[model samples]
Target: MAHTINDLVGTDIEQYLDQHEHKSMLRFITCGSVDDGKSTLIGRLLYDSKLVFSDHLSALEQDSKTVGTQGGALDFALLVDGLAAEREQGITIDVAYRFFSTERRKFIVADTPGHEQYTRNMVTGASTADAAVILIDARKGVLTQTRRHSYLVSLLGIRNIVVAVNKLDLVDYSPEVFDTIERDYREFAAGIGIEDFTCIPMSALRGDNITESSPSTPWYTGPSLIEHLETIEIADELSGRPFRLPVQWVNRPNLDFRGFAGQIAGGSVRPGDRIRILPSGLESTVDRIVTADGDLAEAVAGQSVTISLTDEVDVSRGDVLAAADEPPGSADQFECHLIWMSDQPMLAGRPYLIKLGTRTATATAATPKYKINVNTLEHTATRTLALNEIGVCNLNLDRQIPFDPYTASRDMGGFILIDRFTNATVAAGMLHFALRRADNVHWQAVEVNKRARARTKAQHPAVLWFTGLSGAGKSTIANLVEKRLHEQGFHTYLLDGDNVRHGLNKDLGFTDSDRVENIRRIAEVTRLMADAGLIVLASFISPFRAERQLARELLDDGEFIEIHVDAPLSVAESRDPKGLYAKARRGDLVHFTGIDSPYEPPESPELRLDTGGAESAATLADRVVEHLRTLGLLTPPPAG
Candidate 1:
């Protein structure tokens, strides 16, 4: 199947370089069910195209002989399945990327895994792909994974698709088999909004219908895989969209020059074009489009350049510089399609960090509108999304962000949800549109703000958060601390978990979702009390670190003090002050912390009081008061 490249052997090497450099690039992925020959097809494509170097070929041959599953025949799959575990298991586990070039086009093929558990890996590979080569094992026909991947490809906005019916040689190169598979895939594809796709018959191992037409099937007359890929029109429409350049860096070399640098995400820009700094609504004109090769008269999408503003406006990283008249929408809340990628199931009202383009903001996802059933393409009602699940959700961010609909521009519309505590990317999302309420809601200014309230009370307002397992003396110590502060003329209030549940949180239950909401409400209320210039003491068995962190972020730095009321499970259970542990042990109470649910102890707290030790609650409360005095929380009003 190996073919020679004329450019490699030609005397005009410089001419070849220029031709190769000018070729259009295509990014595509190989996907479908397991054992569909995705890796082998890409490897064989690389080999037949003469893109593999001789030294790499030698190592491939040696590796094939030692550990290949091809019975000593040239194992092409070995070329792309580079992971040790993947080779041992004879299955792809990660997304493997390979680059090759024909004379007409340069190609990047991502060999994504077919396992359901690794669906996130496939999404990562497909996120940037211009096309997709959905392979199917001829013997297996269409499968769940095949349908799932097809749905994902359409969801990701990849319109260019090729259904390569692989391993035809195993099925005796039957035309009937290819036709049936194509019919089934097409029927399924149409259900998921895929109106058009190309179908091909081939044996990736035998290299039939890959680089050239195979004699094994005279019934097949379509262009070869290489022929179609080389000529397929993956449209370049980004240049016609409204211009967007997310400022990645503020290039300030000296006092005289200040420029914003980033790759243009859409449309085109020139030196004299007007631009707007987004979320700020500040206008400026492009002064110079500077590049490494000096200044450019014009710059288009995908080109990285530094743009100086004619006006001295405050532009910074995470800000978008867009076409002035057609600036993108800015909103603090949006309706989005989300794909949960983490092993931990998504819980509503839990805070997460969302990163869109260069901007980052704290966000919380509401309960899903609905999750998609990949098999039937049906929508199912769900409270939370498990790994590999897709749902439509409303995300509320702390600040407004500039964005476009994902259909218009992927760079500005696509974002990832990151767990704030672990910093792991938990989900990928596509913004559909901003919520109408985001536009209507505005903060009204007040003459007596938080600072004024604090000044009137003669104290720096603060939230003393106490967290631990149930029956861990958090409320006991917090009450004592508040009493001691009140005696010294300091304004104070205590928000106890049980008392709040009796009234404010009466509707909330003990489910994980309810627990998150419970803490979220308490946090907002604590913020209000602190803003009123009161030293608010909140005592609760707030289990999750994420919710605790959320409460902390609501206040200014040093205004939120975390105090851990420490106690071993044995000690807390033995005390059984509320007899809650007994009910949990009897299986009467579900989702109880230290029984069914988990309690994430604070890794670092401002103060730790070991209730399991010999220290009395009053003594621990005294220690808390002393720590507060050191932080100046209990200091008297300063002299005028």
Candidate 2:
């Protein structure tokens, strides 16, 4: 009594259905141990979904017969891993992305590598994924890689975890083995603060319980992986946070129009919303929102728009436009989590460009205070960090920037550091919170800042730090430079080690710890003087490189110029201006540098004057002035 389509009324049902169906998309990743069938699983998903073309299927069948690991069965992994090298190695090396759609929802899956060395690639795959399909071999219940990936997914802010217990056919479809792994992983996930995870059983090779529930497992009662993926909802939390948009460009088409253009990183915005500018603290109201098609009434997170302001304020690139009533905290120091990705290790106080949102600033990271143990979840103290290491540390920037915590806004809170010389991306970081001191000690808003003061003085504020052995002519050269600057009508201040020890550092001793604190105080003082728009010259032995670097990090970009008075140790000892060197030769002083203690010379200094050679104090002072002129620090005053 049932009629076929030909006998019935329909002429083109396929075209009718295609015009009306609406499907949402979900992006997920497959990650597990090596040889755990991650790539194979993706290949199976493609073949079973009818996404593989007939021509590709013919090649796959022949390749499978010749060299496949499945005993003449089709090698499904070839569908995802297309590279010849990857196929020969029988492993997934890079992140293989595949796209397909079902009747209900479209899917984009990333098949990530399972080796330890490629763990960073896994992070790349999971960084933007909505769900993670972590494969686990039933024979090996739980592993270090499983835990490691789970921890990484949590760190990347992914909320969904689908544990696929693969290769169930290898265990004879035993419900007992499946239950044990499910229970063991549940406990582990709970311990690591991951509770929103699901577990399913399947064999990626035999096509059991992948798209359809396997008849062999009569005891299990859960939806297949595809069904679960199609139904679960991905809730976007960034859209609910406070409104913020980092200005990427200033659009000025003609005399009558100007606008700030950028993607909305957090919350929502519309006409009539009042906004505040960060670092400058200017206020304005949104007058209009323009899009490519037409004017929009409002736009939420992830939408790019050009916005006009009611007031003509000083807005520019690298500035964040935020809600006036709920502006983010602004500071130069923050404690954050960082993942090192470079071959060169992260060295303390080395300048790197940190790009957060649309803002970029010169930053220096302290040596990692502690590192997280990937397997045991223990925090261990460390002095050095290398590739694939995740650590917590403090970073100091050249100027204040605005941001929220990573938990509040992923788009605005994440940042990456780029190497200055190579321009390669070296690290990825997420802001946790601004140091409590950033809030406790707010920048005192004054009528004048360094730029205004510098204009009045006709020169920029800077610090010339001098370091060498005890009698390296550092003080002599610094004194001559200051005199030459004075003749040039420049204001300056000098902080000599002996003079500072007489008063400011009287309580400090020559021990290593005391020396560190002494330099710290001197750096703070130098920063204060620079803020007052006066050039500062600091002459110190500064036997340790770390302490000198600490001093450099306290100043603004291009504000600290290091001059190494490169006199040989013998030359310094022979021309000893201070009697301390002679006393140290008689064993009267214990920590006299170049005699009893070591002097770590600067690897690369801005100026290396050879007092041991023919360079005179006056000539060296002239060179210093010339370098300053080249840096634009000694330029003419700005015109009114």
Candidate 3:
């Protein structure tokens, strides 16, 4: 019987597998601006290395003949660009991951998108990569996307870099051109804090200096691209750091083996070592270590293992187990390098979910302290982060979690921001440092309590919260309510949004982050006024439910009354008094609630009033006052 291809492959496969099982893998990414031949370079590497089989190569040749953009030449890019859109547009729209192996090492290659708008895709690819090959077109050297990609790889902490000065054949393989581009890139990279990189001259399409040193560039002496990669030693930098494992699952399947299972995020662990559960600050001794391949004596960073503690501690998923003496610090507030990913610009004060390791927390990103100009490497002060923008910002987590600086340990330090509503990944971040005040500051005990201050003024203090769409009569009703309170001779203060923004929050704008801060300041002032035994009336759109809930948190039970002044979108738009809704309709306003942005109404407000009807503002005020009196929170004026 004639041997089939599968039968021949089974017999011949082992010949290619000799010594391959022992080789450690290297994960690297190729990135550049659109049409820099990143996918082609990867394809050329696979071909030159003899990793592509005869049948696959034949199919690739046929694919190259069909949709290939290069005239009558095999489009090596076809190997990596699997999507039809990528081939049709001749541009990578998504990250295309591929795999191949060599005699010395196995490899995982990430072909990242290069467009400025797809910068977030580049970030996602580079996040796990150990090294980066940033390509520059010899015809057009050191463009903005080149600089942008260089900055991102640096930010992601990729130490190993190879600057492939590609398409040398197009520039007639000019040595001077390669040198100038290399020198310029070195200078730019230095400003971005990338201290070291190796530059090589190559034409990924023509296969110069890809696997073998190019004959075209006699002046260049650097090793070939594949030679550098094969010999490059990826340092196991985390081995020296403190051991940390974020418990992903509590394996109490049988109750007999209560092992905490997770991948070792940093350093090493073994039996008999003492470990602490973070945030809780509890300690226990390691009793046993288990793995699918039987019991393990020790496990290093990157290994997944199940560990049993001597004591039955209150360990749970999302908890970090760390070396007792060298555990990471915990803080509710963190300074992070944020890479915004969503079309909706990052709203600093609005609630987002940050999933770090196995732990997830409600977090608010402060308006970016500064935005990074990828082209210029300048730190520009900015209020919000749009899609693909990188910025430095402060993140306030709902609770403290174990963390190390992203520089020291990526596994323990990196996190992803998830949109609370859509559950889509909205951003990626790296923890830089914990805010010092979060750990160092202590609350001073006040001598006077709320009840004592209230008694002194002989009145009850409260915050009257009026929330609704803009032009929904929120401010009108709040003003009327405050007038009634003032008439009763009860000490009172009114905080109107426009009035407050002109002074206290003058630096803020209409961005979501700014709105959150605006409401936050108002809530704080309302609490302070109530503390002084004055009833406070606060009126704002307070569009987000999270921000409204945050205001309620600032007040004592029953002291905060959320009044949802309800009105339909049509009613509010029709009654646009300040012409703000008109501006929003004209597309002058972005993130305008009920228009472009979302408005989450209070699920169950303390008071719900329909203001779209002919109901008078005075009628609404009387209803509120009556409710306050019923709650024993109102006092009548003495006879004047």
Measured by TM-score, the strongest candidate is 1
Q: Name the candidate, 1 or 3, with the larger lDDT value.
A: 1
Order the candidate numbers by TM-score, best to worst.
Answer: 1, 3, 2
Q: Which of 1 and 2 is the better model by TM-score?
A: 1
Worst-scoring 10-residue span by lDDT in model 3: 1-10
Q: Which parts of model 3 are misplaced by more than 4 Å?
A: 1-18, 53-55, 444-464, 476-513, 525-537, 552-563, 569-608, 614-640
Each prediction's TM-score versus the true structure: 0.97, 0.76, 0.84
Q: C-alpha displacement of 45 in model 3, angstroms?
A: 2.2
Overall lDDT per candidate, in order of appearance: 0.93, 0.85, 0.86
Q: Of the pair 2 and 3, which is ahead by lDDT?
A: 3
- Residue pairs in steric clash, candidate 1? none
Per-residue lDDT tens digits of candidate 1, residues 1-640? 2345665557888887887789899999999999899999999998998878899999988888998888888889999999999999888999999998876889999999999999999999999999999999999999999998898899899999999999999999999999999999988998989999999999999999999899998999998898888888978789999999999999999999989999999999998899999999999899999988999999999999999989989988999999999999999999999989999999999999999999999999999999999889899999899999999999999999999999899999999999987889999999999999877889988877787777777788999999999988898899999999899888999999999999999999999999999999999999999989899999999999999999999998899999999999999999989899999999999999999999999999999899999999999999999998899876544534
**lDDT per residue (tens digit) for residues 1-640 in model 2:** 0111231227677664563245577999999888789989988988888888899999899988876778889989888877887888898889989997666677889999988778878888887799999999999988998888887788877888899999999999999999999998888788778877888999989888888888988898898888889888978776888899999999999999999999999889989999999979999999999998999999999899999999999988989999999998888999999988787677665668999989999887876789888777888998556887889999988789988888787767888898865688888889998887766876578988887887888888999999888888889889999999998899999999989999999998885556656777798899999988899999998887766776787788899999998889888888877688889989999877888777888889888888789878789888988999999998755654
